[model samples]
Target: MEKADPVLERLEGQIAWYDRRSQYSQRWFKWLKGAVLVAAAAIPFLAGIEAPRLLIGGLGALIVVLEGLQQLNQYQHNWITYRSTCEALKHEKYLYLANAGPYASAQDPRALLAERVESLVSQEHARWVSAREEAKKTLEKLGP
Candidate 1:
């Protein structure tokens, strides 16, 4: 028996999406870095024990591959970016809900909320696109 608010719905949905992505990226970044550290730390120990050259070489390659994946996918960047967006969105939501900040002076607070929410989401999308393009350019610069 309650009417749903589209603006609030959008705000909440975006918050959840960004938060989820931030957590996911953070987890992946940390996991990949951890793997690289472990592999690297093991290399010296293995070498000291006179392990096969192939094994040591493989560990070095593993470190490269893991670090490359982290750079290419930009998990750390995404984690920070998404987390910032999520926090900004939450700040807007709280302000709108409390009729504080810019919402306080708006005649149509819902419309203002919608506009602000869309703007935040749009800015984030633009940043995401830029990040992809930057990654592409970096790859190109690296060449074959």
Candidate 2:
């Protein structure tokens, strides 16, 4: 049994976290968008067939609600952001492994790797905190 390298572990963990979040957000974003599109497209069809007014109205409301959810949650933005972070982490890992890029002239690649890994994760956390704060302020402005 060997001690695990903390830098490698942190790098792998962050990569996994971002990748999972990216996929989850992407899935939700696509599902919601697809639902909205289908509901929107069905509107005219329902109208043409003289569907019940209540049914048509319900679908219209669904579209509005779904779009609102998408906008509010920002699934697309999260998906893209998380994915980009994940790839950035991967790039750092590769560069560290190859002792290239910023690590090419480093005295301690492992320590540098840890520092860079933490930096990337910290930046992501800062962005998330900022976004949440902005959303809170917007909601406050909107009032209850």
Candidate 3:
């Protein structure tokens, strides 16, 4: 009987969670973007048909709100970051399981794997913070 390593099991669970989260964020972003585009495109047709000004205004307002929601939620950014972290975790898991890469000849494989996982997650968080800061600077440059 093969002994089950708890570290590997925990790593697998983390990977699954991140993968699911990433997919949910991506799906939400896509549906929201599609809805916004459809609404925007309909504005011109509604104006041509001499639709009620209120209706046209409502559509424009809806588009702006949806876009604001997208920006505030940062769905695309979260999806990419989560997916990237998940992939990195999977790679570490595989290397440890196969006894390849840095995992090879490790005195404490479990500790090494855990450290690697932390490093990968920390790097992802740092990258996300940096990206947000850069975006804020760009927005500031563009003015309100």
Highest TM-score model number: 1
**For model 2, what is the error of residue 54's alpha carbon versus the real structure, in angstroms, after optimal superposition?**
0.7
Candidate 2: deviation at residue 34, Å?
0.2
Rank candidates by TM-score, best first. Answer: 1, 2, 3
Clashes of each: 0, 0, 0
Question: Using lDDT as the measure, which candidate wins?
Answer: 1
Off by over 4 Å in 3: 1-4, 128-144
lDDT of 3 by residue, 1-144 (tens): 999877777788889988999999899899889999999999999999999999999999999889877776778988999998999999999898899999898999889998898888789889889877866775678577
Write model 1 residue lDDT over 1-144, tens digit each, in one string. Answer: 999987888899999999999999999999999999999999999999999999999999999899889879999999999999999999999998899999999999999889988998899889989998998888889887
Candidate lDDT values, in order: 0.94, 0.90, 0.88
The estimated TM-scores of all candidates read 0.95, 0.90, 0.83
TM-score of 2: 0.90
Residue 51's lDDT in candidate 2: 99
What are the root-mean-square deviations of the candidates from the true structure over C-alphas? 1.0, 1.7, 2.8
Off by over 4 Å in 2: 137-144
